[model samples]
Target chain A: MIGRVMDAGPGEPPIWVMRRRATAWTTPQRRYYQLVAALPPLRDFRRTRVLPMSQRRLEERLALLHPEDLADLRMAVSLVSWRRQPINRTTAEIAAMYEECMAATRNRALRSTVEFRMNVRTVMVALRLKRLGRGVPSGRWGVGNYTRTIESRWTDPEFGLAAVFPWIPEARVFLDQGDATGLESLLMGLLWTKLSQVADRHPFGFEQVFAFAFKWDILHRWLSYDAQKARRRFDKLVLEATSEYQDIFA
Target chain B: MESLVLTTGWMGIFSPLALGAIGSMIGVGRGGLAAAGAMLEVEAGYGRFVGVAAMPSSQTIYGIVVMLTLNRPVSVANSPGLFVLGVLTGVALLISALAQGTACAASISASKSKAEVFGISIAPAAVIEGFAVFVFVFALVLAGSIPR
Candidate 1:
């Protein structure tokens, strides 16, 4: 997605809104961003291979990595340096899972500042969940019947989304005929797809949250500093990406 | 073609269809995302890899109980509407299955992204699956029960 970042144009609200969501990442999330930004997809190397790696071969490759490789993967997750010991890439995947969630919840209004800001909060909530390890209690337990033990609480921190987000005054409501359950599922699905786009291209050592956040902040700052001038630049990126994907996905 | 909606929507689920608009709003997984860039698809992918997989099968379970309680006997010969209902519900189940499959795809896709595995492209694959489920459940509910 960042491949086209140099190309995002302010004329297109879609790219601008995405840029906003991209801006809300925590320092760690942005670190992963820069690492991804500074690299391109592994496909550059894959083109040399005649046959694609099989599922088993791929799994073996992932499982085969040594401890150093694990550390390299961690380097991509956040700025903190840990042992270069190898661990499965699966650990970092949880956040990478929901990359393009904002795309799925698309609404004309959400593309606007006020509504998308709500989405940013929701994303932050999700990030908090990412921090909390699974199998822990969210506190509601038997009463509200939470599936996970309150992965991370904010909606009442005392309550849940059931008690909070639904009624938040500033929250922008998107019209979805699907149940809340289905909505969650859809957001997750899209996130994985987008994250995969960036993750697959870049190496494990390069991904980081703080770095990307900084870059996003930089662009955001640039945009804020010179809205008229940056708008021209932003439009260039979007027009170019639109043209690129037109050739690709088209 | 029309059933009574059966039992005031037990557990507040009026089938995936009745809650169609709402399900797309509150659920935790990308089972219903419309495209590859969809939010649910992304979340589901990440959710699965960390073993933080979201709720699955509960809706179907509730759906079954609701079906049995309100439209008992699985009758094929008597109610013409049964056929349509079965077909429709089948579509819903199929859509639900689609969401599940995307979740599965997301699980693997998560690995693909991490391992830098190429060739297997990632897509906001939840929508197509939803379409299937939508059709399958419709068939299931409407099957042999046209409510003559």
Candidate 2:
């Protein structure tokens, strides 16, 4: 989550796509593999990884790569063999880089994946936004940078919730009616925002906040639906905080 | 020697002045000065917790002794006062815990420590502990004045 999307935004030149015989796996494929890895007892889907043709193509392209590494590639991509090295090398270049990189690492390479998106538009937008930052060498005079920061982007914070939107056949169990995506977007986004804020203010994250609240068993009381109760809960929490100050701060 | 202890409605509650004494000797006092220093170091992203943790342990020991001398074999199940005292003891422990936790977080932020990423905050943990102390002190004073 922190790696690719968080730093980049709406306007940047599109990332030049090389279209690897394997350039990079699309975002969906990466997410799919990631989800598959996490969902245990789903071994049936795991067997389809070995692709041999891509393996040979990768081997031919990167002359220094080993055959066992090539065998591993076949298993990773589920390919039969490499009929054309240069013809498919653009995509395979991405694959080869990953395979070579993995072989160097101690971590066992189970899946070969890369950024599915080559968003030149997002790049251009980010660059445009960056351009807004520079008024002079002294880094003075630019009102546009502030505007760029608050500017809304399409693939915003709720991307995770959005991805799960279609798959959730029923809505009632998790959410209250009325545009679950919008609400989930709002709620989860709010939660993510709160989580981020609390994490920022304190030395922890929302998950930790949840655990702390879970320990107290009514963390939701701090922000429950009943406004009065939530307020009282907040008050109690605040008084408690003040008392803590009295303990150390006093 | 004159008794420095104070009374409230005919009950002698532990004094904040005494708190300073107790805290100084056992709970975050001279013994904990090193730890306090360590705690501050954590916010700067360093690991000096050996000393930081020491302060609270000393303070907790003081609480344990203070309550134990006033009451014997303190347990939450048996001694209502001590149970509350135990809560207070837990709170006092958190001052050190807070320092240590913060130091640990700083260390983590600096990539000097591995444990900070979980981000389970110590502030609430300390607050939760403070309630125990408050209840303990209340019970101590209330029990003395009230008749069974």
lDDT on C-alpha atoms for all candidate structures: 0.35, 0.32
Q: DockQ for all models, in order?
A: 0.01, 0.01
What is chain B's TM-score across the candidates, in the order shown? Answer: 0.34, 0.30
Total colliding residue pairs, candidate 2: 48
Model 1 chain B scores worst on lDDT over the 10 consecutive residues at: B32-41
Error of 1 at B97 (Å): 0.6
Per-residue CA lDDT of model 1 for A1-250, tens digit only, reads 0112212355655443566576555313111211221221222211222222333433333343344333333333232111122466432242232223233322222122212222333343443443363333342221111223234443343235544333332121221242433443343333333334444444222222222222232233223335566688999999998999999986
> What is the lDDT for A158 in model 2?
26
lDDT per residue (tens digit) for residues B1-148 in model 2:
1122111211122322244234334433322333333333235433333333233333344444444344433233334443344444444544444444343333223322233532353344245345535644654564453222
Once fitted onto the true fold, the runs of candidate 2 whose alpha carbons sit more than 4 angstroms away are: A1-250, B1-58, B73-100, B103-148
